[model samples]
Target: MKNSREIIVDILLKVEKEGTYLQLLLKKELDGFESLDKSFITEVATGAMKRQITIDYIINEVSTIKINKMKPFIRNLLRMSVYQLKYLDKIPAHAVIDEAVKLTKKKGYATLTKFVNAVLRNVDRQDIILPDDDLSVKYSIAPWIIDSWSVTYGPVIAEKIANELSANRAKVSARINTLKTTKTDLINFLVNESVIPLPGNIYPDEYLYLNGVNDIASMKSFAEGLFTIQDESAGIVSHVVNPLAGEYILDLCSAPGGKSTHLAQLSQNQANIISTDIFEHKIDLVKKNASRLGAGSICAELYDEKDIDKFVGRFDKVLIDVPCSGLGLLKRKPDINFNRNEYHIAQINATQKSIAKTAASFLKPGGSLVYSTCTLNKTENELMVDYISALGLVPDCTLIDYVPDMFKEFVSGGHVTIFPFVANTDGFFIAKFKK
Candidate 1:
C-alpha cells in the first residue's frame, strides 16, 4: 500500500495535469483510504495547491535545468516534496527530503535524484524570498486575477484583497437548526468527539471556527439534519430577505439551496418559496437540502431566468443570487484565478443583468428583491443593481441602512460587501431593492 505522502503526491500530480479541482479530486482519491484521516489528506492537497506559485518559483530558482523543460511528472514530484518540507512542520525535514529522493529514484529519474535532494536541502537552509511588492506574489494569485481585481476594487484595496485571498481560510461553518437543537447542545455534542466550534456573529444559527470535524457529514447531528454547512455570509442573505410565515417568495437562480433552505427555516417552514435554477441537477440539490432541513415549503424547479412572463408579478419577495465571476470566493476556490479572464467577467456581468431583470419581473408592487453574488466586481454587483433601478425599480434605501446590526461592519453605500480577510467568510455582495 502507498503511504500518505505517496497518495498526496499522486493527487497533486493529477490536479496539476488535469486542472481538476483539488478538493473534489483529493476527496475521490482518498475515498478508500479509511486508515488515513480526512483532515490530513485535506491539509496535504490544499497546502500543495495553495503554495503552487511559490513552489514553482523555488524550483526554477534552484534547478540547473529549466523547470518548464523538466518532465511533467518530475516537476510535479518536486513541487509536492518541496511543499511538504516548507509547510508540514510535524514531518522532519530530513525525512521529507529522504522520501522524495527515494520516490525520484524509484521512478527511474536516478540522474535527477541527487539534484532534487541538493535543491531541497538548499531551500531548507535559506529564507524563501517571494516578490512582496509584485501584484502576483503579494496576492498569491495569477497576474490576470490581480489585474482584474485592481480594475474592480482599485489598486490599494485590491492589493489588500489579494493578500487576504492567499491567507489560510477558516474551517467550514454551519448553522445549527434551532428547530432540532440549540447551538450549545450541538457544541457539546461535537466537543464530546474532540471537535471544537465557536459562536458566529452573522446569525443566531451560525457557528464559526470549527476544527477537527472535517467529516461533518458523517456526524450524528449532520445526519439527523440538526445543522447545515453554510458560510456565514450566505446565512446573512436569508436574514436580509427576512422571510415571514405564509409569504410567497421566489428564489431565482437558487440551486444547491443554501439560502433557500435558510429562508424556509427562518419562516418556520411556513412560507411558500418557489426555488428555481437553470440546471436539472442543481434543482435536485435544492430538493435534497430542503428535505434534509425538513423545509417542505421550498418548491424546486428548473427554469430559465430570461423567461419571466410565466411568473410575472407573482412573488412578495425574490432573491436573485445570480451567477458571477466568483472573485469574492478566491480564497476558497483558488483555481478560479488561474482560469478566469476579462471576457469571462463581461459574460458573467451580462448574465447577472439578465437574471436581475427577470427576477424583478416576479416581484409584486411594493415587494422586495434581494440581489447578491459571491463576487466583488462592481460590474456584477453594484452595476447590476443600478441597471435594475434604471428600469424604474428603486430600492428602499432606508432598508439598506437597517441591515442587521451584526452585519453593520460590511455595509457600504447601501450594499453589503463581505471581504474574506475582514469577515472570515467568502467575499460576497448583497443589495436589497423594492418595486
Candidate 2:
C-alpha cells in the first residue's frame, strides 16, 4: 500500500493539472483506507488546495524554479510537503521532508530527489512573507471573486469572507427527519450512540451540529432515517417556505433532494411536493433520498420546461433555489472558489433569473415564492428580487421573527444575506414573495 503522503501527492497532482474537484478526487483515491489514513490525506490535500496561492507563494520565494515552470508532479509534491511543514506542527519538519524525498524517488524522479530535499530543507517557513496588500493572493481566491465581493462589501469584509472560505474544517450540519422521528427522539438516539450532537443556533428545532461525529452516515441513527445531512442555511429555506400539512410545494431546481426531502420531512411526509431537476440522473438522486428518508410524498421528476404548463397556478409554495456563482458555499466546497470565473457567474445569473421567473407561474395567487441561492452576488440575489417583483409577486418586506436575531442588521428589503464569516453559516441569500 502506498503511504498516505504518496497518495496525497498523486491526488494533488491530478487536482492541479486536470482540475478535478478536491472532494470528489480525494473520495476516489481514498477508497478502503483506514479512517485515520483517509483523514490525513483529506487534511493535507484540502489544506494545500485551500491555501494554493499562499503555498505557491512560499515555494516561489524559496525555490529557483518558478512554480508554473516545474513539472506538475514536482510542483504538487513541493506544495503538499510545504503545506505540512508550515501548517502541520504535530508532524516534525524532518519527517515531512523525509517522506517527500522518498515519494519523489518512487515517482521515477530519483535524480531530482536531492533537489526536492534541498528546497524543502533550506526553506524557512517563518521567513516566507505573504502579500498582505494583495488580498486575492493572501487568500488564494481568484481576483475576480475578490473584486466582485469587494465592490459590494468593501475590501475588508471581502477579505474576511475569503479568510472564512480558507478555513480548514468546514462545519457539518444535519436535520432531523420528522417523518420517522422527532427532534427530541433523534437527539436521545444520537446521545446514546456516543456521538455528541447539538442543536444549531439558527434552526435549533430542525438542524443539529454534528459536533463529535466523524462519519455521520455510518451512524445507526442516520441508517434508520432519523436525520439527514444539511447545512443550516439550506435547511432554513424549507422553513421560509413553511409548508402546512397538505399544501403543494414545488422545488423547480431540486437535485440531490436536500431541500425537497426536508420539506417532505417537515410536513411529516404529508405535503404534496414535485421535486424536479433539469437532468435525469440528478432526479434519480432525489428519488433515492426520498425513498431512503421515507418521504413518499416527494415526487421526483426529470423536468420538462413544458411541464411548467401543468404546474402553473397549482402549488401553494415554490422554492427557486436556482443555482448561482455558489460564492456562498466556498468555505464548505473550496474547489468552488477555484472553479468559477467572471463569465461563469454571469451565465449562472442569467439562468437563475430565468428559473425564478418560470417557477412563479407555478404558484397560486397569494402563494409564497421563496427565491434563494448559496451566493452573495447582488445581481443574482437582490436584483433577481426586483425582476420577480415586476412579474407581479409582492415581496414580504420584513424579517420573519424566527430569522436569527443576530442578522437583524443585514435584513434589508425583506431579504437576508448571510455571510459565512458573519453568521457562521454557509453564505446564503433568501427572498420571500407572494404571487
Candidate 3:
C-alpha cells in the first residue's frame, strides 16, 4: 500500500502537467484511496498549494540547480515533502523524507535519492532561514498584488488579507433551506451524524464549521434538498435582492442557480423567476438545482445579450451576477493569480459592463436591478455601478444604505465589497440599483 504523501506527489505532478484544478484532481484521487480520510487528504493538497512559494524558495536555496529548471514532477515532489515537514504534524519527519526518496528512486532517479534525503534532513536541521515578517516573501503572494492591496486597503489590512489567503484551509458553510426545514431541525439532524453545525453570524440560516462530514452531497439533508453549499457572502445576494412574492424576476447569468434558487425560496416559490445563462448546458444545471430545491417557479433558459429586446421591461427585478476577473476568489482558486494579467482584466471589465447594461434594460420602471460579481476589482464592480448610474438609472439610495449589519463595514461608494479576509467569506461585490 502507498503512503498518502507518495500518492499526493503523484497527483500534484499530474495536476501541473495536465493543467487541471489541483483541488478537484486531489479530491478525486484521494477519494479513490481506501485508507485515507477526507480531512487528511484536504490538508496535504491545500498545504502544498498554500505554501507553494515558500516551499519553492526553500528548494531553490538548498538544491544545486535552479528551481524552475527542475522537472515539474521533481518540483512538486519537493513541495509535498516540505509541506509535510513544515505544516503536517501527524506525519513523522523521517517518514516524509523516506517517502520522497522512495518516490525519486522509483522514478529511475535512483542517483538523486541520496541528494533528496540530504536536502530534507538539512531542512529539518533549520538550515533554511525563512523570512518571518516579510509580507511578500512569507505569504507567497506576488509583490505587485501586495502593493496594490496596500494602496487600496492600507498596509496592516493588506498584510492580513494576504496572510488569510495563504492560511491553511477554508471553512465549509451551507444554508438550511427554510422552505423545507427549520435551522433547528437541520442542526439536530446533523448532530445525530456526529456533525455539529454552528450558527453563522452573518446570516440567520447559515451553518459553519460543521464537523464529521466531508462531502455534503452524500448527506441525507443535501440529497433531500434541505440545504445547499454556499459561501456566507454568496448567501447574502438573495437577501440583498429581496424578491417579493408574485413578482416577475429575471436572473441573468444564473447558472448553478445558487442565487436564483435562493430568490425563489425567499419568495416561497411564489415569484416567477426567469433564470437565463448563455450556455445551454448551464441552463440544465440551473433547472436541476431548482427542482432539487423545490423551486418550481424558476424557469431556466438559454439566452443571448442581443435577444434582450424581446424581454424588455418585463421583470420587476433583474439580477446580473456578471463574470469578471475573479480577483475576489484568489484564496479559493490560487491559480487565478498566476494566470490573470492586465490584458485579461481589461477584457473581463468590458464584458461585465456590457452585461450590466443589457440586464438593466429588462428592469421595469421603479424596478430593482442588482449587479454582482465574485470579484473585488473596482473596474468591474464600482465602475460598472457608475456606468449604470450614468445611464440616468440610479440605484435607490435609501435601499442601498439599508445593507445588512454584517456587511455595513464594506458599504463604500454605495456598493458592497466583501473581502474573504475581512468578512470570513469569499471575495464578492454586490450593488443594488433601480430604474
Candidate 4:
C-alpha cells in the first residue's frame, strides 16, 4: 500500500529504534524489487541513513519543535525530507514535500502534514548550519569514536579518516573466481560489457576495481560466477592464510563465506575448507556461495565460538575472522555508524578474544593462523593480536606478504592496520601467527 519513500521512512525508523542493519532490512523489503523503483528506493534510504545525525542537527536548528518531542514517525519523516532537500539537488523541494505530506496524510496525521509542509517549505537551501566546533557532529559520527581516533592517530589524521568515511565514493571491488575464469578473461569480459575494470593495488591479479555499475548480483558475469563482490582487504585475508593444496582449513565466523570460498579457489579446490557460522540457518549462505563459486572444497557447518573445544587440533591452518564493531565499513554500510557504540565495541572485542584464543586449539603446533577484523580500533586489532600471541601462538610470518609493496610500512610486529584512507579500502586489522 505504501510507496518506496514511505517504506524507506518506516524501514529507517525501525532500523534506528530496533537496531537492525539497513542492508538486511532493504534486502527483505526489496525482495522482488524490479517491479518497484529499486534505484530511487536505495538512494533515499541510504542517503537519509548516511546523513542521519546531520539531518537531525539541521532539523533541530531549523524547526520550532525539538526532535526529541516529535513522534518517531514525524522525526524520521522530517529527516528523510530534509536529507533530500540538502543533498539530492535534482529532486525539487516541492516534490519531497508533496510525497512526505502524502505519506503523513495516509498515516492519519493530516494536522501534522501542515507542520511538515511548512517546515519543508521554509528551509533555506542557500544557507545551512552545522556543528562547527565538533568534528563528530560535522561528520555525523559519534564523538567518542572521533575521540578514540584522535588519541590513537593525531587530530589531522583522525579528521581525514572521518572525512573519507562520511563523504567518499566507496569503490566497488570484486575478485575473479579462479575456478571459473582467469583474471585476464574476466577483465576482458567486463570491458566488453562496458564495465571499466581498474587494477586493484592489493592482490593485483585477484581483484579488480570498478564504478557506476549497479545491481552487481544481476550482472551476467556475476550470475556466471565469474567474480564475487569482495573488498581487497577481505580478499587479502584468504591469501594471508596461504593454504596449501590438500591441507585442512577452518574458517570461524564464515557466513556468506567470501574468505572461505577464496581459500577453496586459491588452493585450486584441493584444500578441505570447513565454513562455520554461529547460526545454523545462516550456514545456508555459505552453501549458496560455495555452490555459485564452484568451490567444492568448502563444507558448511554450524559451530559457535563457545563450542570451540570440540574442534581442537582439527586443521592445518585456521582463520579466526572474528566479529568486531564494524567501524571499518562506515562508507559501505552507513547504518553501522548509527547502531555501534562503545558498549558494542567492548562486547564484540570480548567475543573476538575468546574466539581467537579458542580457535588456536584447532590449529596444530607450527600451523599458520590469521586473526582478522573489519574494524579500526586497536582494542579489536592490535590488542587482540597481542592477546592471541600471549596465548602460546608466536608471530612468525610477514604481514605485508599479502598487500602491495608500498604498504610494507603498515606491516609491523607481524600485523597490518589498514586505515580507510591509507588502504583506500575497508579499515581492517590483520595479524598473522603460528601455534
Top candidate on TM-score is 2
What's the number of clashes in each of the models?
0, 0, 0, 1
- Give the TM-scores of the predictions, in the order they appear: 0.91, 0.94, 0.92, 0.92
Off by more than 4 A, model 2: none
Query: All models: lDDT?
Result: 0.78, 0.83, 0.78, 0.83
Candidate 3 lDDT by residue in tens digits, 80-155 = 8888898878889998898889889887788878878877887777767778776766887766667777877788
User: Which model is ahead, 1 or 2, in terms of lDDT?
Assistant: 2
> Which residue runs of candidate 1 sit more than 4 Å off their true CA positions?
35-37, 304-308, 399-410
Better of 2 and 3 by TM-score: 2
- Residue pairs with backbone atoms closer than 3 Å in model 1 (clashes): none
Write one digit per residue (lDDT tens) for candidate 1, span 1-435. Answer: 676667777777777677777668776877766644556767766766676777778777777876688787677777777877877788898988898899888778899888889888987887778777777854457787777668876888788787777775744787887666777888887788687787775654455557777577778778777788888877767877989988999998888998998888888888999999888999999999888888788889889645768799989999988888888777777667655677888988888887777778888999998888998777777787679888778765655554656557657655777766665678888888889
Query: What's the lDDT for residue 141 in model 1?
Result: 77
Regions more than 4 Å wrong, model 3: 1-3, 35-38, 127-129, 399-402
Ranking by TM-score: 2, 3, 4, 1
- Indicate the residue-level lDDT of 393 in model 1: 81
Each candidate: RMSD: 2.4, 2.0, 2.3, 2.4
For candidate 3, the 10 contiguous residues with the lowest summed lDDT are 395-404
lDDT of 4 at 182: 93
